[model samples]
Target: MNLPDTFHLIGGDALKTGTGGSLEHVNPATGESSTLELAGADEVDAAVAAAREAFGVWSGLAPMARRYLLQQLARRINESAADLSALSTYESGMPVVYAAQMAAVGPAEWFDYYAGWADKLNGEVIGAWDFNYTVPEPYGVVAAIVPFNGPVWEIGMKAAPALAAGNTVVIKPPELAPYSSILFGRLCLEAGIPPGVVNVVLSGPDGTGALVSHPDVDKISFTGSAGTARKILAAAAANLTPVVLELGGKSGVLICDDADVDSAVGAVAQFAIAQNAGQICTSPNRVLAQLGVYDEVVEKLAAVAGGFVVGDPLSESTQVGPVISVASADRIVGMVGEGVSAGTARVVTGGSRLDGPGAFVAPTVLADVATDSRLAGEEIFGPVATVSRVADDDEAVAVANGVDAGLAAYVFSRDISRCHTLAKRLRSGSVSINGLGNHMIYSPFGGKGASGYGREGGRAGIEEFLSVKSVSAQL
Candidate 1:
């Protein structure tokens, strides 16, 4: 694949000095070195400083000017969609087609979606005795920590709004997949964004603590595990910085007896295990099926899991790629093994690697998995799904809400009333009624409870990057 043009810390044409630490970008699909770049505390500081300086001008610009630039950026992203897709596939180790469709095209979708909202991001005229309105303003510098999985989507989601709302950004990319994130910065320059408006930095395996804890960072937007979110919150607290965390989920799917088994099974499998190898925070980890159709559902799902081709992500025919890494694969297998040891479920398709090299795992399915099993209770961020039988729709809802995570849920049923009923009782931020409906850019996307606070996407997304300022002008 053709590599990115060049990676640099560009702030008004200045390349900041670094501490000389470097990160080796590896193509997980081919197990080859892709890019090597600087990563250290010093580098992090420089990026933050760049954003700090740019915030003055960028944040001071009129909302119209900011919106104009964002619109232009969206157009540039559409122009570079092909190249971004290739780079995303090389770095993310996902199927080329899915990578293009999701990481590349999905980001473009976000830019275009958020761009339209730029002019519409309005502050409300509040109820007051006097003439008063709450004007929303951008924070100074936003510190966005993006996960490697779906990096482009989150980056665009975070950066677009942060920029549209007149905030400069210093993004701390997951070290494992910094290549595409860095290239995205170059695209920003090509899109006519002034230098220092957006800066990209790589953090070590320990995580981007330096960036999160930095004093200059006005706000923190993170997407990762709940365990990591805690640390980020604590770190940001020291600086008294505001934060927006979109954390993990052990999400569930409730399949009612009245549901179409084939359609339900297909929908759950596609979103749960197939998408990004189940790396998504909203991926359904547990499938709570009504006993009436449980057996048929399990059988159909097993067939679907068994048929998925797992190997190199770059292969056009490969439906599922390896887990993030060997360690990640091992963690997922171990979770399944725990279920097996507990005698709660049977590993129907895969529980281990299927290939000779790289971190490949068979598309694993666990049937008759007990509702209380670790595999069913925790967020297994891999292609391992637990299927459990529920006594009724009530029992299904209980099982689905048993976990602390309330991110996203899926309910499949033919009866409209049953669908609406289950959807209401299912404790999640968003629910897919019959199938996984396409998420509209105008809708709110986030979770409640342990899944993390705050919302992203649509009007809520842009507002997350903004702060309210009440103004009363004397006439």
Candidate 2:
């Protein structure tokens, strides 16, 4: 796939030059250079200005018109799924089939889901006054800083709700993998979305800083590490702009003695450490199993890890692909080594990196993980799962909630009542019972504690781009 010589989009036009220095785009599957472009401060300013101008027209449009345009955008995205998925695989190192399902089709579905809400946003009448009502109004211009792991999906995840709420957006795609985002900008134009309504700026930290700090930017929505969220919060504070963050997670899964051990193991293998090469924020990094079934669970998890095919992401049969870069693989391996050296955990299988051209790390499983250790508390965004044994349900819950990051938690129990009880006790933004799914288009998704604040997805997701105002008049 050949990308345009320039990738930055401003006012619906791809800019051929940027003030910021150029960034080299690497194809992780083959460890080869793909494309290069400069995304800098000047481009960010132009995009933000265009979004501010377009906000007046977009927000003034009839809600039905907005809905129709969004539906069309979804259709265009669906039609482009194959090309987008292939480009995403090349840029982000995700398996082609998974990319098509999650990065392309999943995002298209979200646009359709949010499109249904465009005309449904309503105000509430209050009884205190002759004519009083509370209205939900768009924040005008929104800035979305998306992560590299799932660039295409994150773009739709942020832009769909913002647009549905009548807000225009300026997006800063991650520098590492930005082709799909730039392509999406063109697709928006083709779908009849007005210029500036959906602008894409492909810059690194400098451009991101400019967007967040721009006075005209009414709101900010960011998805990535907690440390970066802190920086964005600080920048947004200058203008007192409202911000929503979806940050890191050391998400855990609790397996009770009476749980479906086989299903739980399969979930850990498939969702926790294998999907997207474990680059997901809500991947199950920690596993707390009841002692009665701990050994069996560990063995099964090890077998599944050993079976993963680490190869080219473009291959249909490959299950696990390379991490985004070699540096990322090294970081993951370093963490595993730290766990082993501290005697907090022992490698069950696949502790080392695979011998290949791409940045591949073996799907690793660590047993006897200490509940208080770094492996248990830290977010290891890699294909590794650490298992810790617990004595009972109470201890399992305690161990699961021990970490500071509380984005998601999973529980596996045969008894429905037991699962519900455990789910309530877990202090997380999302808790899954008997499975390992993160977000749905109709449900709110976010994190608590150090995992960061605010919610995304569903009605709550669109509401993030809106501000409430109550008006009253004397009878």
Candidate 3:
């Protein structure tokens, strides 16, 4: 059994076929059979072996060759954007346009942007006692471990930079969203990437662990939960291998007293819980609103959230689609329960699943939430937002900084001084003023502390996949 358009266990197809164990994909939206495949530890090993072998050649390829292939891959991704978008929406239970915005065109944009950097990857010349320079080098075989939510974009964020830097890869896509990433391999092949340079394996947590800890995997770039990130770090440490972890976020959103309450509520709600069903690591889960404007913000946000359409992802009008699975759906709702039990807030719109074959949850708004409330402190990857009232800007900054995870934070204020002041006070990696856009493909983005380490975008992203080597010689 195999998923549609998927060449599972790519590099070691023969060995993968021999593996007795099989994995299956259950489309949350349909509650029926979707895609299935055979994969196991042996198949994982074979994929790594293929990548390890490919690394020797790929890492040695001329920068021009690598640049050409990356550009080709970008073009191919653009050409096949529609199908990829449709598949992501179908499999992940997200709105088609949302999936397209993040997965298909987003990746194409990433690849094309990174393609330009591929040729420009430079070594720096520094003055020593004699002439000397530092050369940037690529790690051999990078194991890219992607999570279930927004899998394609995250994987592309990792693979494009690693490939552009001339590093071969063994990609382990989450079993929940395997098809699109597998389809991504086809795009790579169509773009003329070497056969073994990019290999894909589909499996569960165990399969992912084995792939990450494999001796041949020189570097691991993982995007998942904080708990999972710790384990991946441990696995990489066994071989003393390098790793980049982009993990969970319990980020904060601060709305100033003098700002536009309606705009802030709309932007914070949409950025916090609406996009990709609130699955992004950089999304804002805890909201800090100035006391003077808290009530108005909640009232406005609740009304706007009521207007969001939560239904079939295929529908053009759907605003919020199904959560990843029933289990995930339950977890999301459970957070709201804990919030209620803890006496932190009141549920405004929804706190339960929708009536459907799919695992859907309505847009949830929790008001009068305490700073330490379960909803405010925890990372709920669903359509839920927790609003915490702070006495002043100082208190707002305090509440924003009071989290173990600081991936991204949002701030709003008419005064640039106060905005910049609060932005500096927040401990997050990326701080947005006036509730603007997220970290683009051309800018550095990542988190600190439990949100995990390492940036994955722009020049910083490309640098994460590289190492510096000093060279000095007298002619």
Q: Which candidate has the highest TM-score of all?
A: 2
Q: Which predicted model would earn the best lDDT?
A: 2
Question: Lowest summed-lDDT stretch of 10 residues in model 1?
Answer: 12-21
Kindly provide the TM-score of model 2 when superposed on the true structure, using C-alpha atoms: 0.98
Native-referenced Cα lDDT, model 3 = 0.80
Taking every candidate in turn, the Cα RMSD to the unseen true structure, in Å, is 2.0, 1.1, 2.0
For residues 321-419, write the lDDT of model 1, one tens digit per residue: 876777787788777787788898898888887667667778888898988877788888888878999999888888888988898898888898888
Quote each prediction's TM-score.
Answer: 0.95, 0.98, 0.96
**C-alpha positional error of residue 350 in candidate 2 after TM-score superposition, expressed in Å:** 0.7
Q: Where does candidate 3 stray beyond 4 Å?
A: 1-9, 12-20
The 10-residue segment with the lowest total lDDT in model 2? 34-43
Residues 190-283 of candidate 3 have per-residue lDDT tens digits of 8888878888887666677787788888788988887887788887788998888877788788888898887788786786667777777777
- How close to the true structure is residue 155 of candidate 1, measured as C-alpha lDDT? 89
Which rank order by TM-score, best down to worst? 2, 3, 1
Clashing pairs in 1: none
Q: Hey, what RMSD does candidate 1 come out at?
A: 2.0
